[model samples]
Target chain A: MSIEMTKAEVPGVPLLEVRDLHVEFHTRDGAAKAVNGVSYTVDAGETLAVLGESGSGKSVTAQTIMGILDTPPGKVTGGQVLFRGEDLLTMSEQERRRVRGDKIAMIFQDALSALNPVLSVGYQLGELFRVHRGMSRREARAKAVELMDRVRIPAAKERVNDYPHQFSGGMRQRIMIAMALALEPDVIIADEPTTALDVTVQAQVMDLLAELQRDFHMGLILITHDLGVVADVADKIAVMYAGRIVENAPVHELYKRPAHPYTRGLLDSIPRLDHKGKELYAIKGLPPSLTAIPSGCAFNPRCTQARDVCRSEIPPLLDVTEPDGTPIGGRTSACHFWKETIHG
Target chain B: MGRYVVRRLLQMIPVFIGATFIVFMMMYALPGDPVRALWGERAPDEAQMAALKADLGLDDPILLQYWHYLTGLLQGDFGTQISSRREVIDVIGDALPATIRLTVLAFTITVVVGIGLGLIAGLRAGGKTDGLILFVTLLLISVPVFVIGYLYQTYLGVKWDLIKPTVQDSEDWGQLLLPALVLASLSLAYVARLTRTSIVENRRADYMRTAKAKGLSARRAVTVHLLRNSLIPVVTFLGVDLGNLATGAIVTEGIFNIHGIGNTVFHALNSREGSTVVGIVTFIILVYLVVTLIVDLLYAVLDPRIRYA
Candidate 1:
């Protein structure tokens, strides 16, 4: 009856670790490199926020991890998704499916579309228990009500029979979260979970998610474009541009001193109430097309600090340093002049 | 829901009357006179003809005649058949069972074959199996119903001796199989194509991905998530198609010499039996209306979003 799995018992093993992940989309035009050598790690009870603008491949990385990418158009060329010391990429499809909801669950952005329109919320939630745990219908229904109540949905008993359309958008999203948490997986990957909600509702959902993650000591991967959304919750942040992570740092360190020009530009673009009358600073130029990304640094054309070296050679994610030349632990930047940007 | 059903029932009143009025007007405007047809080859005397006309209320104004006919309908009197002098209701009642049997059999076959083929085609979309199913359905759709009927009768019935060649007066399931299959061919094609398209569209839906993400196996996800949603449009199509099949049974019934309502209507139309024709037309309209109402209720049942209130 207990849906909980054994925790990440080994202290040294990371809950989830992605190494050198490469994904490309094949089209008539050419292959669009969506995720290029992306890697990150999430420890138990850690909140890792992946931040990027539209078409930056953050969502694609999440999809690849979930093994939900549409093939024929999108393909994962190379990657190692290690969950608790086991490689998921090489696992059999059946084995991976068992791991999907039981080990790592996902919450999608558009709750209205993600929930089946024809099915009741309770039935949809109950399906997880019925399919995986082989629970009886009555037991599953009871668990569904319990999950609804856990997500703080009002009138859970009465609204259990209501269809997806019957509930409000926020309620529907809570239902999505409840479904993900039903099996109490070790990791929960939420792809832009609060992007479709109103500002107030967004905070509530995020708060609830953070609370749940902490209470369960689960690894939470929050994928979003808005830096402000993850500022309070994320312990670490990875900023991506075009298909690569341009900067990675602790949340406070990144906020205090962005090591990449794109990260700096994004932080500056956030509108402030103090400067209401002043014009808000916007990033210059658009993101490069994935199929024809610039040779050197993809952001060089739009970057203010473009130089000869930056235009001629692609930069690997190198260890970022302070003005005193002291290396910042767990901090790396793909920019050639990371020191200057950090100092400035 | 009860109120909704009552309102829908009340709304059918005007539709029923309008349908019956159209059939009555068309029969009235026909070239031949029913009185002359009643007299056959022998010419009736002027007084005899006038008396017959007065007795039948044919001498009254068209509007008055229609009103009289409507009142007779309300009183459960469909009038008498001109040829046999039998009550129209009794004639229709005798033929009703045969038509129902054939229609139901054909409809059941259509649903089973159409949905089965559609599911297979959708699961293997863009593959050879899908193409083959599509090709067969296209062939069925392109051919006319009468041609299919005759072809099946000749090939499967007479030539191959697969089943009985003609439908018998007794209730023999074997006798009805060939005709039922022939009648179902075109509709089967339509329903199959619709199902395939709907399934293909639903396969790309976000909920289907959600189903897969919930640890559902590929096959289970397609059946439980994709099939249920895809079937909404197919159910709607079936409701209308069932009514059409009932009316279309006439041609097939005639081809196979089956004594159904369609055959009765055909004979009445050719012989200028006004009362019988009108009675049958009205009955078909009522059946069509009832079938559509049931379909609408089913929509509410299948899709909780569609509340009648």
Candidate 2:
């Protein structure tokens, strides 16, 4: 098999790699290019945080990779989603289905809406084991309780029979996490897992996720627009703007000096204690509408440092480097003047 | 669950009394004395009529008469029918089997055909099948029940001779099939529309997406997750419809000439047989009460969130 050959030939190849993924949504008005040539990688024991504003195609990209895109409206025009040297895009639906929730699992946002309200949490959680592993109902139920306990849900035995409405918001999100973690998947994609939770609970959920990722050593792709929430948990960050990744960097370095104007705008927009009295910075304009993205760089109209080149030509993602031409490891920026933005 | 049932049964006692009392009062309020109406254009001797009235307790006050009737009813003694000189209980016993057969057959057709078509239409919403279902249901709703009955009788019965125009044998399934279809037609339309709306609304729900993402097969996702939630409203509608089907459908019964409760009540009303009408109407009320209670309980079973104390 190609997987065996690739494992032998290419040692330490990324567990999952998304190469040049393009997804579009056809509407009555026009076709909205929701995801435009997104590319990212997730390796074992690594976390890739996809950061973006609304309409940035971060979630859409994840959906495409997971093969859960609503395809009548959304059409995947081009892409190669490589999972362990196999093209998930090219795979049959049956094979892709096997890979989902077994090889790779996903945790959705809005746990209340995501879970089946009629079914018990135990049944929903136990379903994965029953369907994929062919475990007896009793075995699956026992496994479900263990998963609940692992996620720190209080009195797992008692709560296993409880429905989604019975659980608190934090507990519900924990149950969602528990579902994703049940099978010990090689990779997990959590789409805005804490967006629906309180500020205090957000940190708790993130900590739990980080701990689980450590314990499982799974490749994690944490998708969110919150710059601060993913800081401690994410190893690397991909900043997306108007359906494209404008910057990809190791998380801490990007925070210190953002190589893209949009990333800088996002970083500056974060509220700080010292700047409490002063009016907070906000990205001046709204994100570009996907249906009518700018001809050049999609963020050109909103970029404060926009020039004629930025207006007329799309900037390719160039490698970020120092003034002396010493390259920064694992850094790239889609900006005409990356030097000015990062090291100026 | 047990407590809820007991509470509901106790509540039905008042309903039963009220329903029976109203029907009894209406029969008493009719212009002509039922005894006189029973004799058609024939002169009855004044002494004979008075003796018959005294014998039947018609000389007593209406309340006292109703009390006698209620007491007899409690002891499973429906009074004799004046016009036919037959026991009201015997007439009901003859009619109940026919009504049950029609109701059960119609209910099965409504649930199976209505829900089956609805699933087909809803699963393919915005397509040709959905449009066709919409048009058909609209047509069914617009046309009155009597018009459909006559048309089916004229076309399917008289002209084509596919089946008998009327029920020849009240207890026979073969003869009752056409009548049941006519009875079920309107309710089938409603169930289909209700089911389609629910399925369309829930087909793309977030939980459904979760089911798919969880790697659930298409069959399991629709049956276990989508259908379970969608059927809650449809089942509630079907519950009331089933009760209505069992006791109602007087129009269908008349066209088909089946000796069901509705027809029996109709014939009794025309002949001014007070005992027969009051007796059957009371029985219909009891059936409705028990059925609605069953529906309420079934709601809890279908949706765990709905708990009855």
The Cα local distance difference test for each model comes to 0.91, 0.90
lDDT of 2 by residue, A1-344 (tens): 43334443245667999999999999987999999899999998999999998789999999888889987999999888998878999888877887888878899999999999899999999999999999999999999999999999999999999999999999999999999999888889999999999999999999999999999899999999998888899999999988899999998999999999999999999999999899999988888888999988898888899999998899999999988999999999999988999977
True-contact fraction in model 1 equals 0.67
Candidate 1 segments exceeding 4 Å error:
A1-8, B42-47
TM-score of chain A of each: 0.97, 0.97
Candidate 1 per-residue lDDT, tens place, A1-344, comes to 11124342657878899989999999887999999999999988999999999999999999888888888689999979988877888888888888887779999999999999999999999999998999998999999999999999999999999999998889999999999999998899999999999999999999999999999899999999988889999999999998899999999999999999999999999999998999999998999988999989999999999998888899999999878888898899999998889997
lDDT of 1: 0.91
Instruction: Report clash pairs, candidate 2.
Output: none
Judged by TM-score, which candidate is best?
A: 1
**Model 1 residue pairs with clashes:** none
Q: Comparing to the true complex, what docking class would candidate 1 get? A: medium
